[model samples]
Every structure is written in C-alpha cells, then in structure tokens.
Target: MARALPLFGLVLLASGGLMGCGERTAARAALSPPDRAEYMGIETQLLDASTVSFIVRMRGARDRSDVVAYARCAAAQYTVIRGYSFAQHVRTNVRRSGEIWEGDGGFVISPDLPAGRRNLDAEVIVDDCREQGIPTV
Candidate 1:
C-alpha cells in the first residue's frame, strides 16, 4: 500500500506539470518582449497660431518598425492640445514624422487659442509614448 501511494503521488505530480504546460506556453507568448527600438528624446516646437510640430528621433539595431509605431502613437497622443481634445480642436499635418526608417514626423495642432510653449502636455505625451511601447525617439 505504501509503494502504491508513492506511485500515485508521482503520477499526480507528473500530470499536474503536463496540464499546466499549455498555460505556461500561452503566458510566455503573451508576454513576449516587444521588439524595442533604441529610444531618443522627443522634440516639440510651436510654429504659429495654427501649428505645433513634434519630432521623435529613434534608432534601432534591427528594425525601424518601432520608430514608425512611435510616430503614430505620438500623433494620437498629441492630438490633444492644451486642455482640449482633438475632437474639440483642429488637427493638421498630423502624421508620421517621416518615411519609415527615414525620419519621424508629427503635426501642428491648431488650438482654439494661440498656441504657446507648454512643456507640461509635451511631458505627458512623452510618458504616454513610453507606455505604448513606442520608443521615445
């Protein structure tokens, strides 16, 4: 009976390990590291009443896809100018910084009022870009 109990326990342990293999695999797949590009600082400048431009410079050893993604993320995040959302304001030149692997491009925000040099919103956008897996560049 003692030997039988030991065998049963061993079998249970083996089965438990096998049963969790799928879950472990799935978890690893989901958490797979994002192909990250080298991050660079974000540069934002105000052109005039109808425009605010942003540039993100990034470098990657393998792929520039992250840079492109970063550009899109920036465009989406910066759509809001001042305390207003893009839905409440005009968005122009809102695009990728430039061609993929070339340079990234952003747009000028046409705010309801004259645009000024506001670093606070730009700071928030930088944080957002990092969060979205977009390289700072």
Candidate 2:
C-alpha cells in the first residue's frame, strides 16, 4: 500500500503538469493571434472604385459568427479609410478547413447611403463593434 501511494502521487503530479500546459496554451491563444501554423488575419481586395472585398481568417475554436463579425468590422473600417461614409453589404462567403475558419465579405461604399441595400454607416458600425468588444482593422 505504501509503494502504491507514491506511484499514484507521481501519476497525479504528471497529469497536473500536463493539464496546466493545456491551460497555458488555451490562455495564450485567447490573448493573441495564433501562430503561423494557425494564423488569424485579414486581407482586402479592391473590386472597383466603390466595391471592396474583405477576407478574415481565424484558427482553432473560433466560431463562424466571430469570423463574419470580424469581416464586417474590417469592411466598416475600410470604408472609412477610403473616405466613404456608408457601406452596403453585397455578399459574403464562409468556409472552414480543419481548425481554420475564413469569411469573405463584399461591400459597396458610397459617400451617401444607397436606397435599397443593406447599408451601414462606417462610423456607427465601428462604434458598435467597439462597444461590443470586437476587434477591428
């Protein structure tokens, strides 16, 4: 019984160490972008003078909704950066591979909000994202 106790204690210690390692990994991933193997970032393409497309990529445990939100935030910021006041969402495509999620959102930016599309004000969208604690670029 004495020998068994020491062996059991050693096993517990090893398991605790392994569990802590996983916690540290999860905490680090939550705090910052994932490593290159599982990188998260955004890319933008200019489709025309008024239209643009944004792609947001995320890896590991992130939801599809989060990916779409990030893309929307990017579109809003991009509209402001391009000297536009409003953006209209045209379309979006989402895909997932293994642990990575990618969302592509297309927007048409205009100085004035258009008549019949799903329009968003650049400043208002960005502000809403900020209030919601969502990151933008």
Q: Estimate the TM-score for candidate 1.
A: 0.40
lDDT (Cα, 0-100) at 22 in candidate 2: 69
Q: Candidate 1 on 42-109: residue-level lDDT in tens?
A: 66565665355556555542334344344434543565535433311122222234332333454444
Put down candidate 2 lDDT per residue, 1-137, tens digits, no spaces.
22221211222342454446566556334433323324377798998899899988877525564566667778888888888888887777889998788889998999996875366777776765565455567
Clashes of each: 6, 0
TM-scores for the candidates = 0.40, 0.66
Model 1 CA deviation exceeding 4 Å by range: 1-34, 61-65, 87-104, 110-131, 135-137
Prediction RMSDs, each to the true structure:
17.5, 17.2
Compared with the true structure, the alpha-carbon lDDT of candidate 1 equals 0.41
Best candidate (score: lDDT): 2
lDDT of each: 0.41, 0.66
Candidate 1: residue 109 Cα off by (Å): 2.6
